[model samples]
Target: MPLVRIDVIEHRRTSEQLRELADAVQDVMLETFAAPARDRYQIITEHRPGRIIAEDTGLGYTRSEDVVVVQILQQGRDEAQKRAVYRALAERLRERTGLDPQDLIVAVSANTRADWSFGEGQAQFLEGRL
Candidate 1:
């Protein structure tokens, strides 16, 4: 199992639109990754279109345009899987939100269970350590 964290940054035009877009993105991700619904985490941040500055730091950000960055964290250490997941979410988000696909940036990072902490002074996840 893996934990996913999604961060979406875009123009703060309307709350309804932002919420709908975020929900749709999460839906696509959960299905694509075969992840449990509860394991999926999405964080949406709204910014003014004029205030956003997209930079190309391998994540392919275009300056002077609003953007949405989707970060997917998984257990399996597969680069292709991450790309596929990001593309899937970005595609679905664009389709549902009517947002320009060019403005959306999808990035994925995978981590092992040992790397995660459940908080509250809990122990880290370890194989066969339960």
Candidate 2:
């Protein structure tokens, strides 16, 4: 399972647009990571202006107030697949929500399958219940 956390500046996007952005990210995961539809898990948080700061890392790209920070936590995947996911997410989100690629920041964290407990306080993957 992949748990996605999206952080953005408050009032930058409507609720509907945020939903679309989440859907776009999930779609990329489904296509590139082989994630099932039932694996969709996401959290969206809106922060006040200046609370979330992002720099261009010397890329000379200026970030706007509409910046979106997406963090995905899941099991390990190949680097190629991860890169593909990033590209797909940027493309799809841009197309669906008109979000600039420069404004999107994505990060992924890997953990063991045993780290997840879907329900019943059980580690589903480790117990072969996933």
Candidate 3:
């Protein structure tokens, strides 16, 4: 299971656009991470202009208000798979949402199966309920 958090500047994109972006990310996860189809979990947060600060970190690229930050908390995946997911996500976002690759920042934080509880205070993955 991957819990994705998408952060973007407020008023930068319409709701439909944001939904498409989320779908694109989830598609990449499904393809490269082999996550279950029913395991879709995501949170989208919109921040005011100054509230979200993203710097290029000397990459010689400038970020605009359209910048999107995708943070995925998921079970460990191999480096190759992660790389493929990143590339796929960027490409898909560009194609589906017209977001420039430089405007998208993706991060994956590794977690264990025990870290999740689907409901009723139960760790479904650990208990074989999932």
Candidate 1 per-residue C-alpha lDDT over 23-122 given as tens digits, one digit per residue, 9 for 90 to 100: 7776766676666657646666555455555667787545334466666666764666666766776678768876676777665666666776666655
List TM-score per model, in order.
Answer: 0.70, 0.96, 0.96
What TM value does model 3 have?
0.96
Candidate 2 backbone overlaps, count: 0
Q: What is residue 27's positional error in candidate 3, in angstroms?
A: 1.0
Candidate 1 vs candidate 3: the lDDT winner is 3
Which candidate do you rate higher for TM-score, 1 or 3? Answer: 3
Q: Tell how far residue 39 is off in model 3, in angstroms.
A: 1.3
Clashes of 1: 0
Candidate 3 lDDT over 54-108, as tens digits, reads 8998998788899999998988798898899889988999999999999988998
After superposition, candidate 2 runs with Cα above 4 Å error: none
Clashing pairs in 1: none
Residues 1-130, candidate 2, lDDT per residue (tens digit)?
7899999999988889888888888888899988987889999999999999899999987899999999989787889988998999889988999989999999988999878888889888888987
Ranking by lDDT: 3, 2, 1
Looking at candidate 2, what is the lDDT of residue 55?
97
